[model samples]
Target: MGGDQAPQMVVAGLRQAQKLHPNISFLLYGQEKLLSKLIPSDDPLRAITQIRHTDEVVTSETTVSTALRSLKKSSMRLAIQAVADGEAQGVVSAGNTGAYMALSKLTLRAIEGIDRPAIAALLPTVRGLCVVLDLGANVEATTENLVQFAFMGSLFARYVLGIEKPSVGLLNVGVEELKGHDKLKMAQLVLKNNPLIENFYGFIEGDDIAFGKTDVVVTDGFTGNIALKAIEGTAKLLSNFLKQEIQKSFLSKVGALLAKSAFSTVKHRLDPHRYNGAPFLGLKGIAVKSHGGTSAYGFSSAINVAVHLIENKVNERLAKDISLLSQHLVQEMENLSLAIEKPTPIKG
Candidate 1:
């Protein structure tokens, strides 16, 4: 109901996801009349799927206030509610991202010791892929929040991406420590000193994201969202330019035909659909957001992301890592207190 191709792509994608995780069933909240037409009675999903009809939906224009105030029965809200009520293990939605995030916060709340949640997503890189966080969640964050994000992102890369000892980096204008804002400077220091994040890389630039210099890159939402969009736009621009240039002449067209498999490899490696889900890290319950405009394959990938996180118990690992971070902070504060209370040398 929320996406551009709602029930059609939703059902199609779920069918693909079903093959991957045959044990997981679904409870879809949408218009029954429409869904009945889209999902065939003999389809495999029909065997494992349960439909809950609701006309409410969040749109591109739906405000967060409107959703919270009036859309209780909305599909997105109900799905998230299922997670809160212990009726579901996780949720995947291609609806209004803003509304989804807001409702998720209202219902699921942030994991204890987590100041705020960050939208963490995977980006393809030269060394496979890396995780980038704070994508359009919390436009501005304090140093403490950034430090928390570092820990959460690290756990995400390790648990979901299956990377051991993930290297974390602060996204800055330069690799130099003194190059960014005061908050970044402090965040870097926090990560560097934290025993939990010993693999911390001080700073990394935009190019580092694609180069895979680090396994996790942390930044505020404002910068992260802009960088994410820029990378996506550049990928599309390059793809379109290649196609147009290849069709310019008969010889080039023949070359394109001959090099079709090579092009396919490039396309598959760079396809954002392959990495479609962005998890709201630091939430007690799992909620994955899929791009509203993506196709069935892309949505299927998003579903897999949710399934992987749930199966891996990422939030459980995140909770333990955060406790370690908190313990470190407490020890540092106590040491400072001891030093402050130490007797003065009497100006000797």
Candidate 2:
């Protein structure tokens, strides 16, 4: 319902996923009539797939909470519920992101220790990969929330990305400690004090993102969203520029032919289709959220990510680690509360 291609790309992705991993099962959640038209008749894919139909389709007009309330039996809700009930290992969608977030939080709930769920998107860098978190999940977040995101993101890099003691950095205006907003300044302090995040690499600016200065970059949604869009926009602009340059003259066209192989390699390296999905962290079950502009290739990449997350048991692992951390913070807060509540111990 959301992406330009929708069921068409989704159906193609499903076929490709089945070919890649025949054992994996998929529960297609959407309008049955639309899905039936896209699905092939007498195809063997039907054997491994199940369709859960819903009347309501969440659109841009649909408010997050409103969509959740109005479409109790909607496909998105049912898909999330399937994961919560252990019927499915994960849920993938290229639908309304806000609606997906709301429904996921409502159905699967956040992990015990996580104050707010964050969306972590993987960015390809020269070194390898970097995980950028809070990518438009929560518009406003506290210093404490930022600190928690660092820890959780570190764990994700370690367990899922298989990086040992992954470095964490605060996305800021500059490398200097005092360059960012007040929230980031305070967050820097909090992150400095937290022993859980071992590889706290101080502050990193926007330029550092693609350079891979750190394995994880933490920021509030407002800042993270802008940065993500800027990077994506630049990538597209550069690609277009290269094409226009190559078509300028005969000599240039010959040069382009000579560089075609290298250009193709670079395109594949920077292609968003290669990194099309992001995980909504802190949910009880795995939920890989694909971009609304996703193509069949992009959707297929997302399916691969979903398989990796499920096989790694990312959600359960995150839950256990974050739960322990949360309990400690809760106890610490309780002790402070008691100290404030006490009447100075009767002036002892």
Best by lDDT: 1
lDDT score of model 1?
0.87
* Model 2 TM: 0.90
Q: Which pairs of residues collide in model 2?
A: none
Per-structure clash totals for the candidates: 0, 0
lDDT of 1 by residue, 163-227 (tens): 98999999988634347887776676667778888699878999999999999999999999999
CA lDDT, every prediction? Answer: 0.87, 0.82
Top-TM-score candidate index: 1
lDDT tens per residue, model 2, 280-345: 887788888999888888988888888888888777777767766666555544554475478532
lDDT for 320 in candidate 2 is: 69
